[model samples]
Target: MSQHTLLIEVGTEELPPKALKSLSQAFSQSIVNSLTAQGLDVGAVTSFAAPRRLAVSIAKVPSATPLNEVEMWGPPAHIAFDKDGEPTKAGIAFAQKNGVDINALSVANDGKIDKVFVQIKQGGDAVAALLAPIVEQALAELPIPKRMRWGAKRVEFVRPVHWLVMLHGDQIVDGQVMGLQSGRNSRGHRFHCNEAVPIATADNYAAALEAAYVLADYDARQQRIVSQVEACANQLGGIAQMAPSLLDEVTALVEWPVALAGKFESRFLAVPAEALISSMGEHQKYFHLTDTNGALLPYFITVANLESKDPAQVIDGNERVIRPRLSDAAFFFETDKKVSLESQRERLKNIVFQAKLGTIFDKTERVAKLAKSIAERVNGNAEKAERAGILCKSDLVTNMVGEFDTMQGIAGYYYALNDGEDNEVAQALNEQYLPRFAGDQLPQTQTGTLLALADRLDTLVGIFGIGQQPTGSKDPFALRRASLGVLRLLVEKQLPLDLRELLEAAIAQHAALPAADGLTDTVLQYMLDRFRAWYEDAQIAPEIFMAVSAKDLSQPLDIDNRVKAVQAFAQLPEADALAAANKRVANILAKLDQQPSQGVNTALLKDDAERALAEAITQQKSTIAPLFANSHYTEVLSSLAGMQSTVDTFFDQVMVMADDIAVRNNRLALLAELRALFLDVADISLLVRAKA
Candidate 1:
């Protein structure tokens, strides 16, 4: 078959900026998968996404699909032939169904029976003829949450489908996709070039659009925006603060991006930089500039789609638009400063945190008490923790936060400092919400750490207590994130707090819960289970976590240490045999109707292997006891590795079950002691042998 580049373009109105890149990728992959399934070789697929279109250019695609041979079987020969060996109804029907003469069907004899079969070869269609359906199917599978219909027609998409372009080499692929016939004409920039631009060949699609003032490549356009914005910032002797999400949205908003710098009144800088940045970036889609000291520069960069003849006019218009936004932020800052966080907190009483769980005020009160309790345990100032927790959500009622919801905790920090609260208390008000997402920074101050823990715990226990536990698909309250945040604070921060104890403290704060039965255990298990995913992401083996989890540990830091120790132990040469030996000992003890004796009787020991193992266990126990106490599990396991040989020799030479009942029980007691020593760290028996 001849090889050619195939281009498919779906033109529409502006797509959702955040989803544009994903849509383009999904579209390209779907077509590539379909081509491969058709036995057509395809090469590097280039996907292009913009405000008005999503397109893919596939290189080195074949002109026609390859033939595929399929075999069909018919009824048995005994059923297909009459007594005289003439064709029966079944034989004739099979041939007719296969569109062949009855005599053309061949009989095959097998060990079991004889049957008639036909080998049919299919597929040899021109690749261009199949392009339309493939494109349509790909569009149907796009990850659009909702699709809307344009005009009166029943067809729907993310946006109204305007044109479909399917080009193979220099020829147009003839088919209708999304109710639009295939064409070489694609519309360019809606304002700059309000006309159809003809694509002469599949390879010329990107170049053709660029000439018409549309950069079809998403990455190239994004790069251009970044460069332009940086150059604008550099011209003002400042660095541009470009958030990735905002940059992508701006790239999606423009065709031929022209970044221009606009200035706001420097007086507005009196407001917090985060509030001003939020106003410019979140509301206006502007990139803010920061100075050498990393302070806001009262300037913003905006990407314009069309290149204006008088660029100064565009810059002036943007400046005019941003002035009022800054003014509002300034006003909110001033209005909120007059009210102390203590007074603002009273407003929270009216705000419902959850219908059944009382108001936000109630939550704050509970968190304050829990914070005090947790602070006492974690060596934090209980007074500061309680003070911070009470005012943590107070900013939610502030005017600045009402206007800029992203400034919730941050607004509280500024207000608390203004109110002459302690420095740590002010910092904790902001830090309580730190590490909001994965890989985010955790609270640094002890008071902040305790308050963050107390806040998350209260929500988790209260929510779970009310029978609103998160399911596999839904977690509206973000309990999963909260649970992970709790684990991260405990493990990463090296806090020695126990999750079960904290949950109990939090549960006590609640007056009544509909599903209070086992609430502490349920929430604790759910939070601990979050560690499984966390460790899995770290590439630690599931069995390593399972071995540690088998202990039902409630202390995250301790569990983390044990997990690490087990991981280190699994790498030891003796890990597998010791694990197997432990498994064997466990099975022996489990089958006994009575519990084994607490201590092994030396007089009953007969076998040399049993005596040697008994001596080894006693010595290792004394050596590792201090190590285990200090949480130096790695060293303890390494020390235990020395006893693996004695364990193997004992298991191989000494039978655990003895004919004399007393001797069997004594041997069982010795094995039990060995198992308990290993269990102190982790159930090493669950460790899977590393693959050779």
Candidate 2:
């Protein structure tokens, strides 16, 4: 076998900044997989992603794959031969299909019986002959959500393909890729080199690109951007908070990244820092700098694609462009503050929350009432919560929030503050949307927690009331997020709120026309179902959740407590025996027509084993009843675990179904009492299956 460095480059117009990294990585891995699948020698693959190209280089690859001997299945030996062992036409046809003589086939045991199989040595194709199609397949499989066709060519790609570089050692593995002929010429940075550079060998790809003033490696360019951004921010006596997404996007937009400091008017700082930061980071794609105390600085750092002769001109251009953006933000902020958020409440009537759900103002009214109820139940200020909810979405109509949509809730917070609302009320304006996505921060204040939970509950009930329950991933209204938000607030904040009562309150606030028949239960079940993924991530088995779910535990906080209790109980030494016994009791009860009249009569308790089990239950219930009342599920299970030996002994010694009807009924009642003890926390039968 011979080995050489293999380089593949797909040149294009500037790629999408957000998708460049994923595309490049996918392209590299796709090539590696294709080579490995063909039994070819593959080595460490390094990818290069610049604004204009995606390339991968392999340190070790073979010119051609080695010949392989593989078996080909044929008809069973018994079926292929006659009774005398003479070859039939089927045997000849099988050998002919494999291009082998009938006698060349051998009998091999395929585990169950012998079958006729042929072993053939097949040579591999040359790398040059295979690279073109593999490259084409790799491009065809790129994670491109949308593709465009440029020029008259009947080909589609993420961007227009300009050139390609496919080299094996010093030789060009010639083929057409994405309507471009393969070659060693790759264009450098548009502003720096602006000319095609010839790659002499596959091994010199990075060095050659760097010489042309292009940092082809994605990670190297990303690190360089970070270093420069931090240095510029340091010089300005602030730190640049480089968001990973923004950094990756900027890295994709530049070749030779040179971070330089720029500034806007200091007066713009009076505007909310969120507005200014969004203007710079979202609109201008610049990294904003903040001082040690977390105050916004007027300075920003912008990455230039090229090194300018003056460098000051580059800085001035970026600063000049940012000033207008910041000025617009300042104007929106000032204009928005002229009218208080309270006055904007009337505008919500013109906006629709959902077509059937009524106007936005209607939703706010419902959320206001529901939130106040929740606040009162949780010992928070009802009046303050209602006021905050009333004004929370008012920022949607504000000039500042309309201009900077990402700052909707934040602008409302500042506006509420300027309006002289209470501090918690003002904070709730923003806190309502605290967890905007996965793993985001939750509301820190009691008022915010109430508003977030109320708003989501209202939406869930209103939507599900209209029969728009989320179905099979088509959650256009983000119902899953709303559900998770409610669960998180209840569980993480340890709010002692009951979900059943909350859903009822929210459902009561819905318009009377929708006929919320079982809609409340539907919404609660959906919310509880979201708990499955949460507990699964915690390594709590599905049966544990089922155990808690079987009890109709609606309060997420309580449900979480019970789940933890069940999980802990499952590890007890008596768990398996008790769970199996619980399953047996359940089966026996399910098979009976009547439930053995609820309570065991003392006069009917004739068997000594049944009497002993009954006595143990009465004592354990006295201790566990208090524990279950206080939601001390773990302690209750621990106390009940002590009855396992007594339960097993009763089942072993006492015949539950004696010929006497009264004796059988009493035994049934005893078993029913035992089952109810475990059902206080969870359905132990579900635990049985989980342990299995």
Candidate 3:
């Protein structure tokens, strides 16, 4: 068997830019996995993704597939032979079915049964012959949400398939893939070459395409874009603000990238930098430049697909195109200030928030009340928080926010400040929507935090109350994100507010929602589930989360502290022994047919070990109660560890179940109290790792 590099390329007409890289990776990995499963000794794989194509190159792939030995079992030997020790009908039929003579069959016996069997050895085929269908299969399994057909062809793909190339070193594999015949031909950059470029060998694929003005590798192209854009920005004594996603999208848009510097009117900078930057980066895919003081510059960088002979023309064309876009943004900003943000409150009444939850105005009224209530509990100014909540969604009606959807909360901040509202209230308009996605910043001001909490709570409770809970893989309202946002605010902000109290307060504001049992509990559980994932990402132990969550603490910050305290205590040498004792105590309490009395009887105390353990518990109980009250869980957990020796000695000396009914009940009561102490933080019984 000879080893060779295998190349498969599927050419299309401009694949979706955002999905190009991922789709290319999936296609490459799919082919490699399929070949590896077939016992092929394929080597390194390189994937190529450009605007017009997705390709993979595998090195040192064996020319011949490894043989497979298959075993076939037949009828019992007793049934295969006649009474005269001659061939029976069963023996002859089996030989014919296996395509062999009757005498070629053999018999084998196991401990209890005798049977006839045959071993078939299947040989491998050439790599070139095997890859056409493999390439075709990989294309069939691409992660395209929708596929298209071209020119009435029965075949379909992410885009119309134009060409297919399957090469084993210098040899072309012969077959059809996605309606295209196999060949060594691949077209170069759309404007650079416009003609078929022949690939002599699989190893020369990238070099051949590069000569024709294309970067075959996505990462290489992206790095080039970054380097060129930065160099261009530095030339103007400013730094470019190009987001990574923007760079990736730009790389996908061009094959022969040529970064050029262009300038728009400096007057456009009179608009907010965010609006100007949004117009440039989002709508035009241009990289914006910032001056020394971090102020927006008039110049922007654009990546052109071709290096124009008269580069000034390209730059002029880009500048001319951006003038109208900036003018529109300026118009929206200036016109929107004519109306106060407060004036839009009446407009919200006509906008439906949800069919079941009245209108936006009604929801805002509910959020305002909830925010004020929550503010009172957390030392926040109720009036400021309420005012912020009422005006939070008011920007949705403004002309500026309507045109630039990303500017909703931000526009409200500017509008509120213009309307001469309190500085805190103006800031809250923007802060209420902080931390829009994972790892985003949370609200910093007291007013902002309370309003954010109030807004999310109203939506979550109202949505879940109407039985529109998010099912698997479908959260249209982003309930999971809303839930996590609420948790993040509570835990990260160190707010001592009770989650249940907030949920119920928010629920009470919704008169349209039905009064039902478990409404608060359902929304609370849903929010708590988000923490499981959040903590998992932090690499906290699953058992630690289970132990803390089992305690059902209503305050997220308290639960957070307890879990940390428990984690710290588990690191102590005393943890395993105390955890085992707790497990034993739990088992004893679970087996009691009758509920034991809450307190141990002084007269019933019998063993010295039990007496010593009781005294130790009574002493530490005083110290930890105050610590627990202060939410100083770390100190409390450490204080409990001092009683470990007494606990271990009692479990070692006294059996929990005594023959006498009174003694057994009294002992059960003592164990129950011991378990309850630990249960204040977590069910430590769950902390013990089961023995093998």
Alpha carbon lDDT of each predicted model: 0.91, 0.90, 0.88
Of candidate 1, the 10-residue stretch with the lowest lDDT total is 683-692
Off by over 4 Å in 3: 68-118, 514-517, 601-608, 642-646, 689-692
Error of 1 at 680 (Å): 1.1
Better of 1 and 3 by TM-score: 1
Runs of candidate 2 with Cα error greater than 4 angstroms are 76-93, 101-103, 106-115, 513-515, 599-615, 644-664
Q: How many pairs of residues in model 1 come into backbone collision?
A: 0
lDDT of 2 by residue, 604-662 (tens): 88868788898999999899888889989999999999998899988899888889988
Error of 1 at 542 (Å): 1.2
Candidate 3 per-residue lDDT over residues 1-692, each given as its tens digit:
78889999888899899898889999999999888877897889999999999999999988888888876778888898877868789888988888878877788885579888777666597666777788888888888899888898998888888988889889998888877899999999888798898999999999999999889898899889999999999899899998878888898999988999999888888787888888888899999999888899999999999878999999999999999999999998888888898898889999999998888999889999999999999878999999998898899998877878888788899889889999899888888886799999998788988888999999899999898999999999999999999999998998988999999898888775664469999999989888889888987777788889998878899888988898888888888899888988888778778778898886888999999887877878898999988889889889888889999899889987889989988888888888888998888788885221
Write down the worst ten-residue block by lDDT for model 2: 511-520
- Model 1 misplacement above 4 A: 70-116, 689-692
Report backbone clashes per prediction. 0, 0, 0
lDDT by residue for model 1 (1-692), tens? 78889999999998999899889989999999999999888888899999999999999888999888877889998788887989999989998898888877788975578898888777898897888889999999999999999898899899999999999889999999888999999988888999999999999999999999999999999999999999999999999998888988898989999999999988998999999999999999999999889999978999999999999999999999999989999999999898888998899999999999999999999999999999889777999999988888999998898899999889888999899999999989889887799999998888888888989999999999889999989999999999999999988899998889889999999999999998888888899889999998988998899999999889999999999999899888888888888888877888889889799999999999999989999999899989988999999999999998899889889877878989988999999999999999998877744332
Task: Predict model 2's lDDT versus the native.
Answer: 0.90
What's model 1's lDDT at 276?
96
